[model samples]
Target: MEWGMHGWGMGLIWVLVVLFLVLGVLAFAKYLIKG
Candidate 1:
């Protein structure tokens, strides 16, 4: 049970990190296009 919870927490963290990175890249691309 403990290991399952730990793995789930790590997965959630990675998902958030990936999502943030994708958003950052999209924003950067938009800025580059506008500039």
Candidate 2:
């Protein structure tokens, strides 16, 4: 298990990507509901 700083950064990026995807889905749903 040689995972160091690089692995940590990758994990953080994955979390951020997932967060953005969830936010995008919620925003689209809200737009649909409003329109």
Candidate 3:
């Protein structure tokens, strides 16, 4: 049970990281277009 929970936690962290990266890229693209 503990191992399963740990694996789930890691998966959540990875998802958040990917989401942040995608948002960062979109923001950078918008900035480039505006500038």
RMSD of candidate 2 to true structure, Å? 1.3
Cα lDDT of model 3 by residue, 2-33, tens digit: 76988999999999999999999999999999
Q: Tell how far residue 8 is off in model 1, in angstroms.
A: 0.2
Query: On lDDT, who's better, 2 or 3?
Result: 2
Model 2 misplacement above 4 A: none
In the range 1-35, model 1's lDDT, one tens digit per residue, is 47798899999999999999999999999999999
Worst 10-residue lDDT window, candidate 1 = 1-10
The TM-scores of all predictions, comma-separated, are 0.89, 0.89, 0.88
Give each model's clash number.
0, 0, 0
Root-mean-square deviation of each candidate, in angstroms?
A: 2.0, 1.3, 2.1
Residue 8 C-alpha lDDT in model 3: 91
| Whole-model lDDT, model 2 | 0.98
Residue runs of model 3 more than 4 Å from their true location after superposition? none
Candidate 2 worst ten-residue window by lDDT: 1-10
Evaluate residue 22 in candidate 1 and report its C-alpha lDDT on the 0 to 100 scale: 100
